[model samples]
Target chain A: MLSEFDLIKRYFTRERAGRASTVLGVGDDCALLAPTPGMQLAVSTDMLVEDRHFFAGADPRKLGHKCLAVNLSDLAAMGARPLAFTLALALPQADADWLAGFSEGLFALADEYGCELIGGDTTRGPLNICITVFGEIEPGHALRRDAARDGDDIWISGTLGDARLALAGYRNEAWLDAASHEQAGARMHTPTPRVALGRLLAEQKLARAALDISDGLIGDLSHILAASRVGATLDVDALPAGLALQREDQALRRRFTLAGGDDYELCFTAAPAQRAAIEDAGRASATPVTRVGRIEAAPGLRLVDAHGVPLALSLRGWDHFQQ
Target chain B: MLSEFDLIKRYFTRERAGRASTVLGVGDDCALLAPTPGMQLAVSTDMLVEDRHFFAGADPRKLGHKCLAVNLSDLAAMGARPLAFTLALALPQADADWLAGFSEGLFALADEYGCELIGGDTTRGPLNICITVFGEIEPGHALRRDAARDGDDIWISGTLGDARLALAGYRNEAWLDAASHEQAGARMHTPTPRVALGRLLAEQKLARAALDISDGLIGDLSHILAASRVGATLDVDALPAGLALQREDQALRRRFTLAGGDDYELCFTAAPAQRAAIEDAGRASATPVTRVGRIEAAPGLRLVDAHGVPLALSLRGWDHFQQ
Candidate 1:
């Protein structure tokens, strides 16, 4: 077996996207970064574990992509532009093929966003991938969760519930035809990070509060409500469901779209007046944005159908341990 | 059992030092940090896994301290001041007592250094702890491994081999009295990161190249040699052995002192002219500095006795995967 150092050198060290902010990259006690002047650094971390996160034989390439995508999503929610990231990986062994595919998947998305791999650690154990991403944003421009205001429109980028649909298929909770399975699986495996959309929203000052929907729409939206000390009236019928999920029954579609986890779409708030500008920003980034709800002065979330009639649902967001 | 969110809020989030640089800490999608305008951010990450990095049932408190200590040691090696850290933790189950002790231990050290816990993720899985630390250092003053120059004096902070001695005792390869075991175990469990010493050396420009000794002295020092394209003549007999290891036989002591892993002492280089200044830095930091070698023009390490006689020793540094 290759030694730990050899494995890292062969897979991770050889491939890097050089960024000016990275004063020092891997192969040192610490990697030094020089953030652009007058910018605040946005930092987020995420961990993915085998079985608990993905199945035992999940594709290494997709796994790598998803790990970084999740972290970048956090940065996107903060309306920060990707700068660099550090990866800390624990593996059962130094499998050459696995490392090659994983690094390929990782660097592919990283290079797309111009995110550099600054530094990392490798060790032997049950497979776990932890990544901490660094991004830069102008001071006071971050789309903070606490900045949501009354009468702001809640918008979601891209479709939701597909990743959860894929998960349901895996668990045999829902039957999926081959095409639906393939489409949903792709969504689960390689959810796109709305980096450009987020950056555009922040740079153009077109959004208020923003966050990525990982723990279903309603559950994640509640965080913004609590943080901003406000509430929301969600238009459940208007949620943009994945094409595959739309083929399912209405009840199943509602359940998955309303409470399904692992969606990487950004749920952001904007004033009604900025709708045109927000749409322009989305068009510029080439991402789809859907207005699904409205911020309210009340202190509790109220779900509604197309007619503004109240719909009672008791779905909670995903709590890893609680599950 | 506590849910993931509850566990995090109950333990990790409650005890944080309010560093001025942190704009938004735990509970936000991404923590916002305003790094000092003129300084660079030094970043490093480490992942510790059950049974691989530590025994499966190691004390939670010590495990917590050791996890952050190892990362802080990296920052110290770079001559940076700790600013903040993000933790990504995986647990088999939410044991309240364990979480309480772990957070207490983690916060105690963090508060001492004023390093805030900016953000983190908690999940259910086989036990794992990954921490990425961020520190600040003035540009051009970082103690990089590639800065070692020929004719420089090699120095070590405090003693070495005690952690290895403790491991040997655990493995039944060495005999230790109760008191010796306690002392050596403490060294292994709760290492004091030489942050102050490293900062003083950098701020005062007393050192050139430096790295914390984690993978044993010989293995890590060779990295500096390779990076700087210089060689070193190490006085094997001059190495400072841990207090408990001092009673061991000459061969054992030499072997462990030269190639014992888990010693968090700083191995740094400086010119002969700055020896007094380096000593003063050590004194100011309350750390012991011992000169054990000299850099040479040739391109390979040479081991010598106190009388300058050549010593033939075959010792390879610890490689996690190889072990």
Candidate 2:
């Protein structure tokens, strides 16, 4: 079997992008980076574990892509541009084919966003992938959850609930046709990070506060509400649903749309006057934005149906242990 | 049982030291950092898995200290002054006492170095600790393994082999008196990262190449030689051995000094002309400096005894998998 050092050099080492920002890459004790002048560094870390975060025999390529994607999504929520990231990986053994597929998936998305794999650790252990990504943003431009204001319109990008719909298929909680299963599985396995949209909103200063939905819309949005000391009222009918949800019952669809996690879409709030600007920014970035809710002066979140009747959700999201 | 979020909030959150450099830390999607002007960012990552890196029932406090210390050791190897670090931890369950002990150990060392625990992720999984630390260094001042040159005097900070001596006792390969076992065990469990010495050397432009002894002196030194395309002849008699080794036989002592890992001492090389400067820097940092060997023009390493005869040692060092 190849040694840990050999495995890292063979699979993880690649020509780094953003050479000016990354002064040093892999093969060193520490990676050296030079953030652009006058920019603050944005760093976030996320970890994925086997069986808990993924299946035992899940595709390695997709797994790699998803690991980095989750971290980049955090950066997106902060409206930070891509800079570089470090991966700390643990594996059961040295599997060349698995590593080849994994690195390929990781690099493909990283190249797309111009985020380089700066440095990482590989060791003999259970399958665990932890990524710490660093990015840079102009001073005072980072979108934060504490910045939301009452009366601001809340907007969500892209479709939601498909990933959860896919997860349901896996758990045997719900059934879908093979075609729908395939589409939903793709969403569950590989979600796109809305970096461009987030950057545009942040650079334009159109969003008051922003966050990416990882633990479902209601739970994640509650974070923003709590941080900002405000509440929100979501127009449930306006929530975007994927085609996979078209045939589901209203109750099931509402459950999926409101609390289905794994959607890497940005949810942001903007002042009422900034509607035109937000639309312009979305068009420029080629990302669709839907106005799904509004921040309120009240101190708790509420969901209203089309006729203005409130809806109740027993389980807002999956809380790894609490559930 | 506490939720992951509750556990982090209770234990890991502490008042950051370099607040001026941190725009936003903990409780945010991404922690923001303001690097010192014109300085490059130095980053490194290390992971410790239960049973592989530590005993299953090891003291939580010591394990926490060692996890961060290992990463700091890497930064020290590059002569980077640590600024901040992020921890990604996995746990089988949220035991409050364990977290309290772990956080206490981690914060104690972090406070000593002014290295803040900026952010982290805690999840439900097998026990694993991964830390990625960030530091700063002037553009050309960071010591590197590839920069070693022929005729440079090799130096090591502090003693070695005690950690392994403790391991041998645990493995029943050797015997240690009660006092000796306790001392060696502490060394193995909680190592002192040579941050002060490393910073002094880099700031004074003393060391040509440097790295912390991690997987044993011989194995890690091989990395420096292979990277620099140079070799060295070590005076085995000059190799510093911990007090625990004084009672061991010559062969056992030599093996421990050469192949024993877990000594977080800095092994560095400097130009012969800068010997006085190295001495001054070592004095300023209050870290003992020992001259152990000389860099040779040739491309292979050797050990010489007091009489100048070559020593043939069969085992180079421990490889995590090969062993």
Candidate 3:
């Protein structure tokens, strides 16, 4: 078996491209980063455990990408620029093939976003990957959960529910054709971080409050409403479902689109006056933006149909420890 | 069973003392940190898995303290001031009593250092704690491993071998009296991070290179030598042992002190000319500093007795996956 130090050197350590802010990276007691002046660092951490977050035999390559991607998604929701991240991983064994594939996928996405892997710790245990990402944003410009205002239009970037749909297929709760399975599986494995869209929204002052929808749209949106002390009137039929999910029955689509987990899409609010600019931001980032609802001064969420009639639906987000 | 969100809110989130550096602490997509002007951010991460890092049914409080202490030890090695940290935790279940004890121990140390709990993730799985600490340091003043120079005197903070001695007792490899066991076990459970000593070393330019000893002195010292392209002549007999270990046989003391893991003490190198200044720094920080070796121009480690007689011994550091 390879020693811990050897494993880290062989798999995790890599040469940097001389990122100016990274004063010292791997092979030190700590990695030193010089944040740009006038910029506040946005930080987020997420932990993924085998069996709970992914299947036991999940692909190492995709797992690596998803772990880092989820953390980057948090930064995206904050409208922050990705800077660097640290990964703490635990493995049952030091398998060269698994490590090689994992590092390849990790660096591929990291390189694309110019996010350097600064430091990490690896140990022997049941598999777990915890990543903490750091991003840069100007002060007072962050799209905070408490910044939503009454009459603001609620918007969503990209589609939602495909990851949840794929998960249902895996759990045998739903049947899927080969093509549909592959397409939805890709959404679950490689959800894109809407960094460009989020940054555009914040920089252009088009979005007020924002968050990435990880645990279903309605549940995550409730966090924004609760924090901002506002309510929302959601147009349930207006939600942009995943391409595969769009083909499902109305009831299935409604459940998944409204309360699906692992969607990794941005749910944000903006003033109605910025509709044209928000549309322009969508086009500029090459991402689709959908108007799903409107924020209200009332302190409770209300659901409606396409014909403006109220809908009574009982749905909740994914909770890891919920019984 | 408590939901993940409820578990986090109930135990982790607390009212902040209005630390100026923390712009947004918790309850957001991401925590925001404003680093002081001209100060670089030093980051380090550590992951501790139950059964691997600690015994099963270990005290939650001690486990929490050790997890954070180990990460803080890295920051101390870099001569950085504690700023904040994010935790990613996995647990088998939501036990309120365990959560209370863990958070209490965690926050107690965090408050002592004025390190805020910026953010974290909670999930259901086998117990694992991963903490990434962020600290502030002036650029170019980080005590890097590569900064060691030839002819530098190597110094250590606090005592060593106690943690390993406790491990030996637990493993039934050594017999220790109840009093000795308690003393050594405390060292293992709640080892203090030498933050003050490290900061003094960096701020006053009292040390050339430094690293916290985690996997034995000889093994960790080798990292400094390899990075700095230097060798060292260590007076093995001069190593300071824990008070409990001091009562042991010389051979046992030497074995544990030279190759003990989990010491969490600082192993730093400095110019011999600054001996007086180094002593003053130790006094100021209230940490004992002992000179046990010197960096050499040659490229190999040499272990010597107090009389300068070279001693031959075969021992290696703890490797997590070593077979």
Best candidate according to TM-score: 3
lDDT per residue for candidate 1 within B1-323, as digits (tens), equals: 67777788888776445667998899988999999998999999999998877898899999989999999999999999999999999998899999988998999998888889999999999899999999999999999999999999999999999999999999999999998899899999999999999999888889999999999999999999999999999999999999999988999899999999999999999999999889889899999999999999999999999999999999999898998
Per-candidate interface C-alpha RMSD? 0.7, 1.0, 0.7
| lDDT computed for candidate 3 | 0.93
Q: Model 2 off-target regions past 4 Å?
A: A16-18, B16-18
Listed per model, the TM-scores of chain A against the true chain A are 0.98, 0.98, 0.99
Compared with the true structure, model 3 gives a TM-score of: 0.99
The model with the greatest DockQ is: 3
Q: Model 2 residue B126 lDDT?
A: 94
For model 1, residues A15-84, the per-residue Cα lDDT tens digits are 4456679899999999999999989999999999999878898898998899999999999999999999
Name every residue pair that clashes in candidate 3.
none
- Scored against the true structure, residue B117 in model 3 reaches a CA lDDT of 94
Task: List where candidate 1 sits over 4 angstroms from the true fold.
Answer: A15-17, B15-17
Model 3: per-residue Cα lDDT over A1-323, one tens digit each: 78899999998888776898898888899999988999999999999999888889888899889998999999999999999999899999999999998998898999989999999999999999999999999888899999999999999999988999999999898998888899899999988999999999987778999999999998899999999999999999999989889888999999999999898999999999999999999999999999999999999889999988999999998888994
Clashes of each: 0, 0, 0
**2 against 3, candidate with superior lDDT:** 3
Compose the digit string of candidate 2's lDDT tens values, residues A108-180.
9999999999999888899999999998999999999899999999999988899999999999999999888
Fnat, model 2, is: 0.69
Report the lDDT tens digits of candidate 2 across residue range B233-298.
998888888878766788888888888999999999999999998888889888889999999989
